[model samples]
Target: MKYNKTYIFGITLVATLGGLLFGYDTAVISGAEKSIEAYLIRPLGLNSLIHGATVSSALIGCVAGGMLSGLFSNRFGRKKTLLISAILFFLSALGSGFPETLFFTKGEPSIGLLLAFNLYRIIGGVGVGLASAVSPMYISEISPAGIRGRLVSFNQFAIIFGMLVVYFVNWSIAYGQTIEWINDIGWRYMFASEAIPAALFGILLFMVPETPRYLVLSNRDEKARTVLTRINADRLRAESILFEIKQSIGRVTERSSIYSYGKVVIFIGILLSVFQQFVGINVALYYAPRIFESMGAAKDASMLQTIIMGFVNVIFTVVAILTVDKWGRKPLLITGSIGMAIGMFAISWLAYNEIIGISTLVFIIIYTASFMMSWGPICWVLISEIFPNKIRGQAVAIAVTAQWAANYLISSTYPAMMEYSGALTYGFYGLMALLSALFVWKMVPETKGKSLEEIERLWKK
Candidate 1:
């Protein structure tokens, strides 16, 4: 039966907005961190401790959000939980931009104002955490198996596209502006800019239907049938799919334990999340300008180079979306791991010899492009669809929780590691990249073209 391509795409786009906000929230700091330090940190005479905490405070919220996602998602439906996240995003954007609103006087930074700012960031982090886990899960549950990889992969594309969008927004907001103006006034606008998309996401979400899988699991069979029918355009085909979903669990119960499928499935999901971060992708993203500066590129040139890298990331992610179903998950992951390792090792060698030039740029692009094509998107693809339906929300929460934790651990430690040795720093990430390939090659299942029910049965073995 022919699927309703237009209808399926419409909802998928709405879901991916969550991904866009996730990227925007995380990377928006890169543009505003210096200003945050200047406005909030210096005025209060706080040391680097306060400055670092203020800049990365969102991760604290992210950890809490990821930890709580399973509970929220299981108790509430996915759509409502996502709607909650959209609200969080909107509030965080406004609160982060105007922490002094209706309370502290403007331009007067006190310890209270500093704490208030961190609180707002943590709120946004919670939104990032929820969106990070739920967006892909929602996409996977709705998408047909044949095209599921591409559709879910689009969420990652949205994430990268979001970061790129923020990068441009930050640049435009700062360009030709005085540093004092930027610190005093411009940074607020950068944080506030996210409100537009968050409000848009919240409003648009109401127009899309809850996923059929979620509807079925919640025992709303008739509603599930309707959604599936709309997606499939053939009532009989929709009925068949609904029957498979019902048969998979024999009932609608999200209360089944995460260990219901045994520990291996959960472990695989967690490692996929960990490896995706431990390979040092976020380091490249969160510190692109810093990394380029370390290579002696001027400030302006580094920003331009970062933008160029963002373009490369988007292009390569598209490659993954196009090829993931056709090439299979394992192949692309393995090929990309090798590409990342070679790129990282090349950079390590160059750093060892104290080399900095266009070759460094080339290798960095190679490493990042490889990541965007493989682990960047494929990890989320696997995590979303890997677990049995009964335990998906719980499993994804645990996995995503580990992901945010590992992200914080890796990203925070990069500066210290680089101080110890740039060569060794990249060498370690390169080694992790190689091990990720081995992990995928041996353990990660190739989920290409398999229905969620079909894939679930594999764990029963």
Candidate 2:
């Protein structure tokens, strides 16, 4: 059977725009967070908690969006749910940039305007939540069995690429600018830059066909057969594949719930999502510049360091894509977790000693790269593959919602944690990383080189 490589790649690329926007909206605030604190929080008589809340406000919407994903994706299909996410992304970007245009004067800080700004950021968060769950699921459903891990990993690549792009964008916006200007206007431009790609994602999404698995679920067998033919480029192979999918669906009765799939599978999925966030990955991302600044680097230099970290992230995510299917999931995850534990433990030592210099940077790079290569991408891949098809949408929604909720807890508490003891904070993450290695070893089943339906059968066993 000949493969339609270009056509499949094009469709995968389009679906990954959801991932690109996910990374963009989430990390854009990293560069602008301090400026936001200066302009909005301090002037309005707020404290660190409110500043943290405002910075992480999008996570609240993420929880809502993730919780709603099953209903939305199941009812509307993956492509349309992504379209809705893109619309939300577009609106959030513009609204966050000019939050005061409708209700308040420019440059005048008010509680009302502050509320409006958070509202917009949260809208963007909702978009992130939707994309985080649906994008990989969409990719997995369309991908061939042989290279599904590599292909779905492209979404992670897009995610890291998006983060790297925004890091550069944010740095460019702040470069050669005075602090006052960055506070008053530069941050707004940083927020607004996301609008361009958000619009692009929304546009291209219409060009891609719905996943064949989705078509099968909708009982459109002929349409499913057509899409599968194009993707597989073999009518006979497509029909066989379609039959297998139908067989899987037949096993699912209308009364099936998430538990019907298997308790262990759902537990593993939820735990995977939780451990991914609890290891403090997002804290590193959302507060990248601040972490660097705490190491005695100047503001601009800190942003520069953030860009460097973003670059490392992209490079290592590519490594993950190249090696995931080849090396298998367990080796990469366990290896990466060990690396993270080492880097974080070293950072904790340095922080306690008040030694902030080359060593700190090197350790931070190591930690970020380790995550990019392992848990960062592999976790998503497993989540997309592990659940039974009958319960995938709902199971993924529950796991992702837990993920965002954990993200909010870790990220929102980071400031206070840092203030109290940077040593303890980093040391704690290091411990989680070590524990994560053990958890993966004990609980996670490797899904490499398996069809989605085949992998689903593991839980039933």
Highest lDDT scorer: 2
| lDDT against the true structure, each candidate | 0.89, 0.92
Runs in model 2 lying further than 4 Å from the true structure: 102-107
TM-score, one value per model: 0.96, 0.99
Best-fitting candidate, measured by TM-score? Answer: 2
lDDT of 2 by residue, 1-461 (tens): 36799999999999999999999999999999999999999998998999899999999999989998988888999999999999999999999999986575765888988999999999999999999999999999999887888888899999999999999999999999999999999999999999999999999998999988888888899999999999999999998889988888779867468798768898998999999998999999999999999899999899999988989999999999999989999999999999999999999999999997989999999999999999999999999989888888999999999999999999999998998999999999999999999999999998988988898788778
Q: Candidate 1: where is the Cα deviation over 4 Å?
A: 42-50, 251-255
Each model's backbone clash number: 0, 0
* Model 2 lDDT, residue 416, Cα: 88
